[model samples]
Target: MKSGPDDLAIHQKIQISRRTAGLLLGSCLVRPAKVLASADPLTNKIVVRSQLSAGDPGRLMNVFAKAYRGEPITLGVIGGSITVGAFATTKENSYAGRLLTWWRQQFPRCEVRMVNAGVGGTGSMYGALRAGKDLLSNTPDFVVIEFAVNDNWTDGEAFEGLVRQILAQPNLPAVLLLFMMWEKGGNDQEMQANVGAHYQLPMVSFRDALWPEMAAGRLNWSDYIVDTVHPTDAGHAAAARFITAMCNNARHADLAGRSGATSSLPSPLHSDAFEHIDWRDAAALDPHENQGWHLDFDDKGVAAWNAAAAAGRIAFDWSGTGLVAVFADPLLDPRRIRFRIDGASFQTLDTLKQPKRPILVLAQDLTPGRHIVELVDDDGGSGRAAGQQVRLIGIAGIGLKDDWRR
Candidate 1:
């Protein structure tokens, strides 16, 4: 695999914390391991394996046969916009659709049923609620859960809730957690896998698997994403390739025998920040490196306004970031709508800070690299502080660098 990102120091910290590191590494290196004790007919004692090397495509046909054994295999995909085929121009172009095509070719003699159960703007908490209808109702043989982009929308409670709901299913279907991305660099990979481990389920981390390829000038973010979170046609194809490879390697637990661009994550992942977030194990991320726009409320006191608070400020700085997206809401200031990113001057934009309404800000063509950003509120003459509750949603990081765009 290409050398890990330029941030070796950060992964070094992860390597030092052996326990967390081991799990993180396992999450990446030995992805989708068989649970051994599953009750699901398709998975029961079957274990999904990983490979460190890329091999022939023929092996994948065998992997599919082993997993299906000629019986009708039903696959259910659950997640946010990506799984729902958001930007895919045609149904046949979606990752799910492409996967179905592969399944049809691989198992022409056996029946394969595939279904899409993705909802836009929903997090894992909502995913859990819909599990009964989207996943369990169909009694799928395999279920793929995609929720990396939506994790930041809800608290950890909701994430775990989704995991528990799926693992608790009586059918005990073989479950694969697909941790997708919003921008090229936005997911908490280590934390995601830790949660997947809670249910002893296998995972497919598109971010960790794809990042190095993007970094080495072999892949690019735009090739995959149409907008911020949605994947374009090329992105779907790349995802399909990864799925095909994963199915090809499911039978080998050890990396000794495999082929075709094996995933590059080190075995046993860990990180200090992921620990603070309550994740059991996680793929390492650079703690010092900053991507996208990082904004946090520095003030201890939140302005409690019964109406739109006349202007608010959360001092923030950016460092040569590119193509970043911003989200804000009045969970903290609603009424007087519009906000600004203050540099030496304020760049005013509409920040629909309404109570419960999510405001999204897209700032493309950033000044090449690292820069600082400060959040500014504009109360515009209308003194409507309406239940003053201005809050900061979050930021998503997307990379437009030529190397990342492959």
Candidate 2:
């Protein structure tokens, strides 16, 4: 993370096509995250200078001013497993939970509300798809986004889209970018930092502080992580401190300078396709479509069609220039996922070779309008339909009717 936002690489001058713009401003939906709760034992305000990047504290000025006034404030966070408190002894021991504790300490008189919209094994694409419904619906005044460890695909288009979406919220929330790392020091923080720098958002990195220590044998990675990715209770505490310091930095920022954070949303930092999106899960499908579909949670308890081959002729309606579908995981064997737009020719998605939560872009650049989709359950017996073991997630579109596709 950098201390300035004047990166020559900020190429948001590129414009989004009119058709793509229309695809935005619709409703969307996706899985809900486990609410973040509990207390953090470490109360000391620790600011690791190396881990802190002031970026743009513009939006945060108002948040701190609100805290100083002892006014109520709302906070929202979106991220993957680590943000979900994975590997922590308890949800409260997760960094999110600890931050909740820290916020209370700084402004005891100000009531703080939090919405933890963290899901396991998901990334910016999923975050962008569901953020409106999951995180922004509550109208948070401050938001934290952590996807570096999970946004394995795309350079940063999806990440940029997610950031832009949050900034576009009416609340004008203060946004913070958080980057977590794997034990081996592998992560997408560098890629994600570009988006943070472009937006001049405050960023805190746990890897910068701990990774070198681990390399020098001064800090035992196992002491902070029981696995290669998820952090241990100690690890969560370590991360929470940097976040606390960043918050302090924002609180102490020049108020007059930060007042300008409300500048008009910039042009496409990358592609705006993800800027406005709508996600539809099985819950949004016609009840009659449930005939062949057996609704069941996956091993991780995420609601999905464990056996969609049983869901006969499922259907739904969407209006957009593009559409996509999310599947639970890679197919154990070669398979096909078949669907059609407006009853047009069937589009087939051969089973994904990607890892968990593989997505298939069903269609793109189609004429914008209300289009119905029909999904068939195929038993893989030399058939044109989707495979029998198909576990269908919900469908999504770029345009829709409803808050920007909730």
Give the candidate number with the greatest TM-score.
2
Q: Which stretches of candidate 1 lie over 4 Å from their true place?
A: 1-68, 251-406
lDDT of 1 by residue, 1-406 (tens): 1334533543443233333323333455433545522422212111122211122223233335445567777777888888898899898898888888887786787788887888777666446544665677887756677788876644454466555555445545555666667665677545555554434444555665555556676567787777777888877765665565555345332333434122222222221111111110011112232223233342543222121234454443333223222233323333243333435555544343212434232343455444444444555543333433344433322222332321
TM-score of 1: 0.49
Best candidate, lDDT-wise? 2
Q: Tens digits of per-residue lDDT for model 2 on 253-332?
A: 44434453457776766777777677777656543344476677666666776554432666667767677777776554
lDDT of 1: 0.49
Q: Each prediction's Cα lDDT score? A: 0.49, 0.69
Task: State how far residue 390 of model 1 sits from its true place (Å).
Answer: 18
Q: Which RMSD values do the candidates have, in order?
A: 17.3, 10.6
RMSD of 2: 10.6
